[model samples]
Target chain A: MSMIKTDKLIYEYAKLDDEGNVIGTNRAIDAVDLEVEPGQFVAILGHNGSGKSTLAKQLNAILTPTEGTVWVAGRNTKEPENIWDVRQSAGMVFQNPDNQIIGTVVEEDVGFGPENLGVPTDEIWTRVEESLKKVGMIEYRHHSPNKLSGGQKQRVAIAGVIAMRPQCIVLDEPTAMLDPNGRKEVLRTVEELRKKEKVTVILITHYMEEVVGADRVIVMDKGSIVMEGSPKRIFSRVEELKKYRLDVPQATLLAYELQKKGVKLPDGILSTEELVEALCQLN
Target chain B: MSIKLENINYVYSEGTAYRKQALKDVSIEIPHGQFVGIIGHTGSGKSTLIQHLNGLIKATDGVYYFNGENVYADGYNMKSLRNQVGLVFQYPEHQLFEIDVLSDVCFGPKNQGLSKEECEKRAREALEAVGFPGKFYSQSPFDLSGGQKRRVAIAGVLAMRPKVLVLDEPTAGLDPAGRDEILDQIAKLHKESGMTVILVSHSMEDIAKYVDRIIVMNQGSKLFDGTPKEVFSHYKELENVGLAAPQVTYIMHALKERGFRVDTSVTTIDEAVEEIAKVL
Candidate 1:
């Protein structure tokens, strides 16, 4: 069974007038179908207002679909009884680490989720230590979150989610507010967590480089899935991605430009090493 | 006309257990009409340094001169200084709170004691400068998209007619095209108005493409200050400080290591492509 499945999901919010009356409806998420198997790493790429975030919201039932259905861990998100089960099955991390972290101390923050889930006191501490260790933040367990760097705070945020022990994790532009090193830290931690815990990973981001390592990539535009394939296959269509207001990784773009200039380079070079290898092979 | 900071030092929570120095003996000079990029890791004092520009945060020990006038002089008007040195904070869209985009932009100039018509006129000009569509002028800022809201926020600052515009991660949450559009408009603004632009950003690629000069900050001190090609030549050292040169720099360096006769100092894609083509 799939860890997450959306069947023609459609989410619409009413366009309100000055007096707060609904004038019409704005389709934020149009009819779309998506499926993610357990332990798979998926990346969703889109511009702001492209409905990628709306689709992520549907995974944990933050916003139930206006039409169609979303299933997490074989449970329907729309069903009120299954809401807890769906949420427990899929953890979410947001863009701003400052907004997501609540507890003062690092370990306390990581234990917040499981504590709310009614986990016993002893197990909460155990889960807290284990999750902190997994995210490489165990040393900062007693430190104040306010003093931590952006990358450290974000890793603590991930540790909080990990303590929930969800079958899947959905990160909505988690690295948007971080610096280059911070972004690298969060991505490495996500990759490491995915391997160790076998949790399904769905990352939504605007950074093209961050998606290069994903097993699959989904391109969203105008509230619909416009393209879907492996990262290399999707990046090969650089012109199409640009049409949707998205970009290929820098290396891929450089290769494409070189190809256009009549240089015999392969399509979809995803990294500097790959591009260097391709260029060195020429002549 | 220029901005100068000499021996600037900023310490947070003085005499307390959490006392820490955010900026240490940083001295730099930025001339008028120069587009400068400041690159640094988070908590490296990038924000604190920009905050000092518009007198938002006063340095504990430093001398600041703005256009030949001492900003820290007794009885100097900080309000006028702020008007001349506009600072746009990160995630600027969150700062937008006016009922409509036009009025939101007008707030800054209006606060400067300008007449209502003058305020609106400046607001309109600023909006147009940012390439914001006229159709969205009357719409609520809350109704606009993230990119559009960010533009309106920038317009609010630009409406004040500042001589030196400072933006802190203006493209933090924007998409690729949106980022390019904003940066290009800023570049155009710099070209046409000749106003100094101090852009603090994390993306080395954007910095290399737009800015004429780059300043690298680490551990609250100026680590490097030079042209894009010069600063990026120290890509290895930059990586040690949790920052990096643009991807093209790495690609060029790797190609050079592979015995290809390529210029490792190439920062932008265009330069890399041209250099690689020349070598091939």
Candidate 2:
């Protein structure tokens, strides 16, 4: 059931000298292994320079693994011949919407991917329309991408990938540039995508709130898979996650603090209501 | 530092084949010393609308009024308006191109035709205001961490000494600490400077927890304008418009759906905890 898999994933950026010579290689992702099952929402957490994004890129073959292997939909990303196939099966969304969006209009931008994929004219429009509707952007289909909000443009960017109908989607800090409302929209759309399209989602983010609803949570530190579990399990270790420079959800953190201060309670509290119900049961 | 948008409409590439009507008949008033949060689903015209208040974009129809007079009036001093209404753009780090942190932060004040001595003082103060240490002034912004580079960008805007400060998605892309650091600094700046503050954000949690008032937009129209509670109460409407308030509210809503008598009025964790204490 694993749709995307990684083995000993390693990536290095050239540490150049003053004269532009490669003095050494700074290891971005180091000896990382990951697997994502079909129809699962996976979140990766790491601090800056921790190589989370590097791994997201590797899944789509945007950057080949320096010393590892990645398979998307059972197609090896490192295989030169399978580059296009791997990419078509695993779409990528990045940090900034302004940079990724290309079309002048929303629908046209969504259609660009299918059109480039050599889909027939009639079918390209069909895919574009459905993708736009999926993201709840059909109303602004004729609007300029430039005129769209950061969140809307990003949805269009997602629509562009959905138009390709990829089996798996890798989003690198997709909500990093959105406002609160926009982030909600994008998250809802991603959740809907999993249910409606059943695409495997690999979401790399640092926001603890965003990960609460995810199916599985993977924590990366110094370019390695440091922690892997469901959100409840990952969030249960409050001090441990905080040591890695990650924040647990506020309610979870509060529950942990209260536990430390002599309250007999459970380990992980995912939402406010849970914490409220637990504390309310005081004997 | 009040900003009044009077029937503002922004059209990109006016009279061209690729023209876009970004903002349409949008009229809203933000008063002095008010903490307002602007929220919208993508393409809802919040970005376009905020840009007009600072004269970043000329309104195609209607006008933007700062204080009392129209900003886009004939021969209006746009530069002065800019100096008074500092706008920190989203992805602000992309705009930092100076060689050193000091020079970059000084860019805004220097453009205001201030003396080098005055500009330097403001830059130093602004950097401090944004919580950047003294050591960062000499270092290149590129050498700093992503969070620090973002701080430098905000400092650059702060150096303008604007009475009305506008931030576009200031906490986007930052981790929880980075987000809290930036949002707290903004709150402090508003208190210390007594400036009118407009925060544009996507996190309903952040908006609900911080700003006094909330403005929601959808497809270039203002869906509703009121307190966060008032706006969040329209959960169905917001969901229909591709928006939601906070996760806590959603959870409470879900609890209500399941026959739990938990108060759905709470928009945050602390409030939710207090309410659930009463219910359970």
Candidate 3:
């Protein structure tokens, strides 16, 4: 069964006049459809104004869609009674680690989510340990979050969501702020979580390289799913992605250019090794 | 022109209930005009170490010397050191409050007590330095895109005309293109401005492409200090410290695991291609 399903979702920001008067509305999302199977790792990609973030917000019910419905684990998010349920069902990790962190210490911060759900003290600690270990942050559990690097902080945040034991987790540009090392740390942690915990993963990011590892890639532009395919399939179409103002993986772009210039390399070369292997095959 | 930290230790809220040891006997030196990247798992004292560089946080047990002069020594005047070593923090947009881009960029220079004309000139120059158009001076800083807001924030620091510029996660909220643009601008600024630049980032590819040196932090201790190639060459060590090399490096290493003999230390795609071309 699909873990997440969205149908014809629409959202609009309210346009206002200078005097707090009501003006028209500006559409952010048009008709959109999306689905994610259980244990799938999905990546959402787009430019800054492309409504990708808006769609993510909808999944968590941070913003209710203007039209259509979203179902998380067969529960409709649009239903008023299930807002908290939806939030718990689909946890979100935002781009900025500083803003999302609430507690002073790493383990305490991870415990916050489960604590809010009224989980008992013993269970919270257990969840905290398991989650921290999952992200490989157990060693720093007693340390304060402020002293952590951006990537470490992000891992702690992800552990916090995992502690909730949610069925799905949605990250909105989670690694956007981290350095090269931090970005790798957080992405590796996320990938590991999907493998070990069997939790559904939704990662919103602009880095094409990151999407290469995802099970599926969803493209958003003007609040719609413009492209949906495996990373290889999506990257294979270099021209279509470029028209959406999105950059493919660097190697993919280079390979595409080489192919255009009449190299016999195969399409959708997402990594340097793949490109090299393909070129080695030529002649 | 290098900045050195000798046995630096810092504890937040020294006497309060919230007292926390952020750094512990840390010692490292950033050579002049060198592009150094600082990486660590969270709570590894990376932020605290960088703050001490410009005297934003005075070390409790060590010394900070800018060009071998004690910046925290008696009568040395930390205010001047701050001007010489400017910091652009993560989400630097929080520092922006002015009505327009020009006034905001001028804040640092104006606070330095430069003449009004000098402040204006520096603001314009700094804006251009970050690649913002001259016409953007009149636009409200809040009116620009997230990437533009970030540039304006960096420009604010640049207006100070510091010899050393430090950024803490400068590309946090930017899109991929914006990420590329900002990193490229920092590289260009380093080359064109010849300023000492220290970047704190989480993307290995970013540091691999721009930084001249890499500094690894874990548990609030300086673990590795060397060039990108040298630092990333210890990918296993980095992973043990809760880090990984760039994707290209990872792929290269994976190929090596599968019995291929290509070098894995190549940092950039262009270089990776060149290395692979020679072997393949």
- Per-candidate DockQ values are 0.85, 0.28, 0.27
Candidates' C-alpha lDDT? 0.93, 0.85, 0.85
- In candidate 2, which residue ranges exceed 4 Å CA deviation? A1-5, A17-19, A37-40, A68-82, A101-167, A177-198, A207-209, A249-265, A271-283, B4-29, B58-65, B69-76, B218-223, B251-264, B275-280
Flag the better candidate by DockQ, 1 or 2: 1
Worst 10 residues of 1 chain A by lDDT: A274-283
Which candidate model has the greater DockQ, 2 or 3? 2
Chain A superposition TM-score, candidate 2: 0.96
Instruction: In angstroms, give how far residue B134 of model 2 lies from its true place.
Output: 3.0
Q: Which wins on lDDT, candidate 1 or candidate 2? A: 1
Task: Summarize candidate 2's per-residue lDDT along B213-269 as a digit string, tens digits.
Answer: 999988787889999899999988987877776777876776676667877877876
The candidate 3 chain B region of ten consecutive residues with least summed lDDT is: B271-280
For candidate 1, report its TM-score.
Answer: 0.99
For the record, the alpha-carbon RMSD of candidate 2 to the native fold, in angstroms, is 4.2
Candidate with the larger TM-score of 1 and 2? 1
Q: Which residues of candidate 3, in runs, are more than 4 Å off?
A: A1-3, A16-19, A37-39, A67-79, A82-85, A97-167, A177-199, A238-245, A248-263, A271-283, B6-31, B251-264
